[model samples]
Target: MAHITFLLVVVIITALAFDFTNGFHDTANAMATSIATGALRPRVAVLVSAVLNVVGAFLSTAVAKTISGGIVNDGLITLGMIFAGLVGAILWNLLTWLLGLPSSSSHALIGGLIGAAWVGAGLRAVDFYEVLEKIIIPAFAAPLVAGLAALLATRLAYRLSGRADEESVTRGFRFGQIGSASLVSLAHGTNDAQKTMGVITLSLISAGALPTGSGPPTWVVLTAGLAIGLGTYLGGWRIIRTLGRGLTDIRSPQGFAAETASATVILTSAHLGFALSTTQVCSGSIIGAGLGRRRAQVRWSTAGRMAVAWLITLPAAGLIGGAASAVVVHGGTAGTVAVAVVAVAAASLIYLLSRRSPVTADNVNDARNVTVNPQPAPASN
Candidate 1:
């Protein structure tokens, strides 16, 4: 009993650490375009994202419930398995952050759970059908749908406001960007923070802290929300640089459209208990918005890199989690200490590397070849 209690505490702390990374890692999904377009200052944009994230957490926990209930058959899962899964997710997040790849944090977590569970209790531990219906189908579909929506919204915003002064249109849309970005942030909270909540709750379930089949407790919700909010404020500028300027050139109107599209898709997914990847969905939307402009340049190399990252995220995270789980389950307390030491060392190394190539608000805008909200060059009729 004592061992189980202690491990549960350790898992909770680790889960929040992962949640913090999740926040900064995916913050770009909500604010990258706004920052690129001067719709909001970088600091201000992240602050709004942080707050809305907290509010969004309260919007629903259907996704959380799915995570807590769906992916792995909870009856066969143990506390060590959950811990191993979190380790896998934390490691993957750090690796991607170092490489400036905008991978899906949500998928990493899901994969970790899947891998850990499979190792602990074999294939029967996985609820493949539910995983297929809820996670897999949307994994392929959400991004395309989000991108198309963004493309159409961009076309509409331009068509309706085409007659307005270029400066006026930008000014008006900047205000609109704030509102839309807020929605994206809120939607993010509903989706991302709940992932941690689900993990923590599952940890509790594995440790028998909560009765089986219960959603996350209020305390669990608040802690998960706060961890992610703090991470959002810290801001992963490397990821932001890749997203804001690398994938696409975001003008004010396009930024506005992309954010609006992301918010709608994510909110709907969370409501439906589908934990969609904000990184993928938002990145796709940005690319689609870029394509909406006839004269805009879209960078295919960066997009390809992101797609590759997406393909590997789940399985990579799972393998890491599976290995870690086996060690922790058999080795006990010393193993826990060893895992902690490894995590701290890896996190510290990533931090040191981040300083060498820092990305800030001033430099973030400089990364792009284009500036905010330019007049589209007249096309040949």
Candidate 2:
């Protein structure tokens, strides 16, 4: 019984750690454009994001319900299984963070839970139908729709502003970007933070601390919400650099378009109980915003690498989760101890490494252009 309780503690702690990483790692999704376009200063942008995120966490519990019961069989999930699953997710998140890839921490957690459940309790432990209906279908659709919307919106904005003075137009759009970016931040918290809350809720349920199938409780919501918001305040400068700089230059207009697009998709997904990837949606909008410009360059190589990372995150984390679950079931208390040791070592190492290549607010906007050639081929030449 004590062992079970200990595992439950680990699962909750690990889930919060993942939530913290999720906040900083994905902050760029909502506020990067605002920062890039000078719509909001770095400090102001994060502050807004943090506050909106906290408020957003209270808006909807539909996604939380989906998570508590949708991805894995809540009944089959023991506290040990939950702990093992979180281990897989935290490792994947750290790995992607080091590479400066804006991969989906949400998907990592889902994949881990699915994998651990499958390994520990067999294939019957999963609900493939719900996973497909909820996660898989929305995963493809959300980003594409958001990206196209931003593309059309960008085109319209440029066409309307063609006769305006450049400085005035940029200034006007900067103001608009702040409002839209704040919406995206709030939308992000509503969607992203809830996933962690659901995980904790699921842990509580499996441990018999809560009912078998219920949405995240009030305490779960508040703590997870605050943890993620705090992490957002810290910010994910490496990813902010990659997003704000790497994926085509983001101007005030582009920033406005991207934030608008991201907000639409994120809010829509939350309403429908779909667990969409904000990272992918934001990246796609960034790409789409680039395409909206006539001469803007799209670095397909960087995008290609990101696509590969997305393709691999789920299955790779799943394998780790499955293996971890197997050892956890066999070794019991000893395995829990080992998992703790590994978690500490891994977390310490990643923190030390990040300190070496520290990306701060000062250098977060430094452009790392991929193309050497300045001009592009004419469309109708």
Candidate 3:
């Protein structure tokens, strides 16, 4: 029993660590466009996002319940399996952050859990049907829907204000961004924070601390909220640079439209208990906004890279989780300790590498240095 308690404690801590990474990693989802368009200063944006994230966590537990009960068979999950899964998720989050890639933290967590569960208790342990219904379908659909909404919103904003003075119109949209961006932050808290709560609750159930089908406890919600909030406050500058500048140039009007579209999609999914990817939604919105403007150049190369990252996120994280689970199951407590040490070491190395070419609030929006040379076409003759 004491051993189980210790393992549960480890799993809970690791789960919170993953939540923290999720916070920073996806910070760009809410505030990137606002910062890019100068609607909000980078620091101010993150601060607001952090606070709203905590508030959003308390909104509902429908997503949390889905995670704790929907994806995998609770009866087969163990504390070690949960720990291994979190380790996989955290590593992937850190790696992607270091590379300035805005991959889906939601996908990372889900893939990790699925992989660890499968390895720990065979293929039968996973609920493929639920994964399809809840995660996969939403993963593909949410972004497309949000993108269409943003495109229309952007077009409408332009059409409605076409006769107005350009400077005044820009100012108005910048002001509007404050509210729309805040909504995205709040929606993020409600959606992403619940993922950690669900993981912790699942651990408790596996350890017999909570009954199966139970929702996250009050303490669980509070800690998960705080962990993600703190991460958001710190901001993920590398990813902010990528999303805010690397994808496409954003104006105040487009920022407003993109953020509003993202918030609506995220909030709707949260209400439905779908573990949607906020990063994908925001990226789609930004791209849609870019396309909505006449003669706007969308950076297809950067977008292509991001799409590739999204495609591989699940399988890559799943492989790592499966390997970690196998190690833990074979080597017991010592194996768990080894995995922890390795994860910490890898994370530290990535951080050090990131520091070599750091992206900070001071220069996050400076995309003037970026140059894309167009390929010359072969001579027809």
Local lDDT at 99 for model 3:
81
Best by TM-score: 3
Q: By lDDT, highest first, what's the ranking?
A: 3, 1, 2
Q: Please, what are the lDDT tens digits per residue for candidate 1 over residues 1-381?
A: 888888889899999999999998888888989988888899898888898888877777574454544678877887778888888998899888877788989888888888888887789989888778767788789999999999999988888888646898899999999999888888788778878888888778767778987888899889989999998988877788888898877888898889888988887876775667888889989988998876887899888888898989989999988887777877788787787788689789877766655666667666642222233562321
- Candidate 2 Cα RMSD (Å): 5.3
Off by over 4 Å in 2: 61-63, 66-69, 213-215, 369-381
lDDT of each: 0.83, 0.80, 0.86
Question: What local lDDT does model 3 show for residue 193?
Answer: 87
Summarize candidate 3's per-residue lDDT along 191-283 as a digit string, tens digits: 788888987887787788998878888999999999999999999988898888887888889999999999888878767756678999999
The best-first sequence of candidates by TM-score reads 3, 2, 1
Q: Model 2: which ten-residue window has the lowest total lDDT?
A: 369-378
Q: Stretches of candidate 1 above 4 Å error?
A: 59-63, 66-69, 368-381
Work out how many backbone clashes candidate 3 has. 0
